[model samples]
Target: MVIPPPVRPPRITEFLKPYVLKMHFTNKYVHAQVIHSPTPTVTASVSSQEKALRSSMGITRDVAAVAKIGKILGERLLIKDIPAVTVFLKRDQKYHGKIKAVIDSMIKAGVKLL
Candidate 1:
């Protein structure tokens, strides 16, 4: 028999009751936001599609860009007085590569992973 690894604290708690991080990826860009789940409102967001990032980054869809996006999100949340957030990945997505980079960078930027 095989066992699935335990889910992490942040990943287990969806935004239905607390702040959550959401991600959107396209062939040309990466977007992310923090949502206040109960009311379904966005608290903070960042995207590689912004003019400032588009001119600075050669590839918006890359892992490095996603990491930068995560860092930005963390900073934004901190400014909003939100110190922690759980990641809310869609069913089609798994935690790896770009997703992992985002989470790691957010932690490095000082956002407590739920």
Candidate 2:
């Protein structure tokens, strides 16, 4: 018999920080948000599934679509006065492919990634 390894949760510090950016990607869509930790509120959120964004791209699962969502998210964050953030990537996620595209687009949109 094989025993499954234990699962470790994300650090509490991630939720205690001032501004943290969390991203989620699935087979059909990508979503991102800037969360205010102290208040535990989402300051801004963007997803490829949004009507405006989906209508513009016509596809929600590609890397380009993820980049577009990131751009929009960054713009929204800037509008809300959040200029920089610490990224919180899930343990199963890597900083490549679609994730890289999103982060690059956010930087291009003027949001600093800490």
Candidate 3:
């Protein structure tokens, strides 16, 4: 008789990429953060909901605002010695418009997309 080898749980968030970039869009604001999947800890984050950013960027739901958020997030990650990240978009989210903008800006800022 033989038994199957242990398999990793399906609920594990990160399998290939250790660092992950998560984003959320609200009625009036956009939020983003980088998390260390294993530890489930946030490494860096930025949002249009932040007081300082809200004061400067009036409209937070626009693609430009999202791009800025991605750039800032990439910079923050690099500052913390994270060189790459994998994006975790929502189910209905597609790699278009604002999503594309964020990924592009992050790549431009020197963060490799995995």
Question: What TM-score would you give candidate 2 relative to the actual structure?
Answer: 0.83
Candidate 2 global CA lDDT score: 0.86
lDDT of 3: 0.88
Per-residue lDDT tens digits of candidate 1, residues 1-114? 999998877643453448888899889888999998877889999999888878888888989989889988889999999989988888999999999999999999999987
Which ranges in model 1 have alpha carbons more than 4 Å from their true place? 1-16
1-114: candidate 3 lDDT, tens digit per residue = 999999967865445578988888887888889888888899999989888788778688999999999888889988999999989988999999888988899999999988
Which pairs of residues clash in candidate 2, taking residues 3 or more apart in a chain or in different chains?
none
The clash count of every prediction, one per candidate, is 0, 0, 0
The candidate 3 region of ten consecutive residues with least summed lDDT is 8-17
**TM-score versus the correct structure, for each prediction:** 0.82, 0.83, 0.84
Candidate 1 yields a Cα-based lDDT of 0.88
**Once superposed on the true structure, which residue ranges of model 2 sit more than 4 Å away at CA?**
1-16
